[model samples]
Target: MGRTSRKRRSTLTTRMTIASAALLLGGGGLVAVNVYASAQEDPGQDAGGGTRQQAQQQGQQRQVATIDCPDVGTSLPDVPDGARGRVDGELATLDSQITEAYQRLASNRTAAAQDPNFVQNSILGPLKDKRGAVLDRIGQDIRRSGGRPPQGLDGMAPCTGRPSEQPQQPSQPPSQQPPGQPSQQPSQQPGDGSDGGAGDGAGGDTGNGNGPDASDFVDIKSVQPNVAVPRNQRAASRGTFTTACGRNENGKFNPDNVIVAPGVSNGAHHMHDYVGNQATDAFSSDDDLANGQTSCRNQGDKSTYYWPVLRLQNGKDEADVGADGGGKDQNVGEIQTPSSVTLKFDGNPTSKVVAMPRFLRIITGDAKAFTNGDANANASWSCTGFENRQLKDKYPICPQGSKVVRTFRFQSCWDGANADSANHRTHVAFEDPRTGACPGGFKAIPQLVQRIVYAVPPGPGFAVDSFPEQLHKAGTDHGDFINVFDDKLMQRVANCINRGDRCT
Candidate 1:
């Protein structure tokens, strides 16, 4: 933070290439796929698991001078020593993970290995999500330390590993002689389990056990840019329209529905909590949202607000029995529960906008947040007493009377025409927090911000349940919304946004 003291950050980019490959490619398994995974611990680790590793990493960093890379100038990465070291170590560790994956292939092979989402989101998704949260925290630390965090991962490590044209079969039969490489074993074919999918588990990437190089992969997806914003700071008051949504602890429900990732079956393998409009689930029609109960003080507003459920696992809660190494891990230690959550939506600046279209579906949180080790996983955590405070850990433990919370902000800039994008994004953008204004090419729509406070009582148990794909990633914690408001109600809020008036 203090000028970073040294200049060795650039070398990390090269190293990150390996980390990124392992993370994006799916835990060392070499494919990116989202599927159900049973609880399995790293050979030697405890429940405090991922974050616990981070806390311990604090003391072991090698204080070397930063190196200079042509792309990264002389400045250190916009990260603190603690977090920088953690990511650096993880990147370096990924090389060995890939090797381990190769070793495991010698014993068993499943066809699911061919699917990228399977390993990426299931086996390794939680791992990378946890790591991404820390990386996200590192950026926050940079900002808190008075450093200007960079916007993207350019010049950071490269992750370009792509799958070969076809899954690789063992060159030698199981009984054939091969002293160096582990003996090839008969592998499992596809459709091995009841989760409902075909996976032959084709044994792929059978190299000399050194594992694939980071360069072997390709950047399959795009990364989100960082938008610097103040903590708990009020808008410039330039836009007169303002709205507040309330917190509902027991208000989480799925409605057996989903729209964001439609046909994914209920929209979530995990549960979500809702506040604003009570009945906005996947199956809810406009009438359902219009007639639903209101959590906010105003009975007139029915905007929907929802996110993942955080269940306490003091070892007795049935909600978190199998969740190991997470907040509720007993055999292992417990992970951190985010201090509090904030959910809000903002309108575009520069120009006034009318009501949002009927049945408009807006998604701001990163679906890959909890599953990928990308920059978007940079989630912020804090407490109520010092709402502006940002914690570097998974979640901060709040002092007496204050609750932990997670803040979720929706994109405020609309395309001026389309209500949604094919990907649920691109149609809208974020307003500049520094100026409270929308960037050019985007029309400022109403901004919605929701803060979820976890008022946990004094106790020894603290756990939060997450979607299975998240595998209990703290930063993967996100929310979704669908504007199912009646035409009349939608017009009222739209009018307030256009007239520069506040709505409660």
Candidate 2:
């Protein structure tokens, strides 16, 4: 059977129960599910009988991975003027309406919770199909725009309180109001607590709504300076670094707060900011990010070590995802390391960090390309080896002397962290535990990390069969995959590539 494409929508429908009902019942209601039907032209369907149970089931089908934040500096190609304007206009209208509904929901909950007759109420039922349509429309917009900005490659939008539709209010002045009340308050009524002020939602600035601006992007350039590489920790030259994969000795996952805010402890700060970072969710180490610098102020509580950190300077004018250099770039270059480089081992503060990048190359493609670290997990390929290897291992296996390479041609579909749900590529890292280096495997590599892919011309009597299939595949060891952190050789290689000559 042919594969089925995933269905997407612009707006999402959410069911909320008034807190007053929960308080009266002495417990939360059937909040596990919310039911909403389609906006049918027929008004009679609205009155049809059905318990909340059926509606709850429909919600299950709509659950999806949380949308991620967009890549900083990643810019979408110019959209057609007409389409762009239409999308912008529609979004503004939807955003305004949703904002209003959110206010009502907040107010109703506050009032209902204080009232004695508060019954379990589902906003989704009252808000109706409009909520779902909005979510559907937004999702569709992202998909239709070639998965570019506004939607963002990561689908990272600031969503709140199950999206809603405009509410119907009484045409006449509310009877419960005080005597001599005006029909409506001025547009800027401070006393009207209708819109939950700034505190209700998280935004960039107070005036423009707290959505993501270009500045919110965590650009490599922005964070590069903060990454401190003391002379001892620096590669003898430039463009090289080391990497290690290990676990927290305490046998506890490092919370998101500790990962993003390196100086802060886990319990000291709010954890929301670090939710989408790779170090917290995938690898579980700060050394990988903060340049071999782990957040823990104390030492030897569990385990920590110095990983690799590279310093690169390239002046290539490659096209990037962003108009400004905030997104992915096609310009490729490398950083060469000095003969002697030291990585600071955080565990043994006295010891130096290990590893450096001696080679550099860059290629573009989906999983078929050796350069696709974690971007191409679903693309299929046939291998010459792997007869007895366990399916558990996620890479191809080779006999003593066999090489592997992709057989098909596919367009480059690198989505970075946006399409992380279906990724298959793995990064390489040295697994140096206190006892010894992890066997066969190095440390685990993630898509979030940076790497280099170089090309080596076929040599005389170069037997492809002599290579391991794992290394032969697009990203394996043999086929031009090298760590850019190696300063000594990679720096020269980068310069050579730029000068149109091979590194001597």
The prediction achieving the highest lDDT against the true structure is 1
What RMSD does each model have against the real structure?
A: 21.6, 26.3
Worst 10 residues of 1 by lDDT: 61-70
Tens-digit per-residue lDDT, 1-504, candidate 2: 011122222111221222221222121211111112221222333456643433433333122101111211112233332334334333333333333343243334322222322212333233334444554564456557565334442332333232111112232222111111112111112221232212122211111111111111111111111111123222221222223322222222221122111222221111011111123322233234323333232211111221111111122111211111101111011212212211211111112222222211111122111211222221221122422211110122223343222221111112222111111111122122222122242321111121221121111111110000011121211111112232443344334333333222
What TM-score, computed on C-alpha atoms, does each candidate reach? 0.48, 0.21
Per-model lDDT: 0.39, 0.22
Local distance difference test, candidate 1: 0.39
The TM-score that candidate 1 achieves is: 0.48
- Give model 2's clash tally: 47
lDDT of 2 at 48: 69
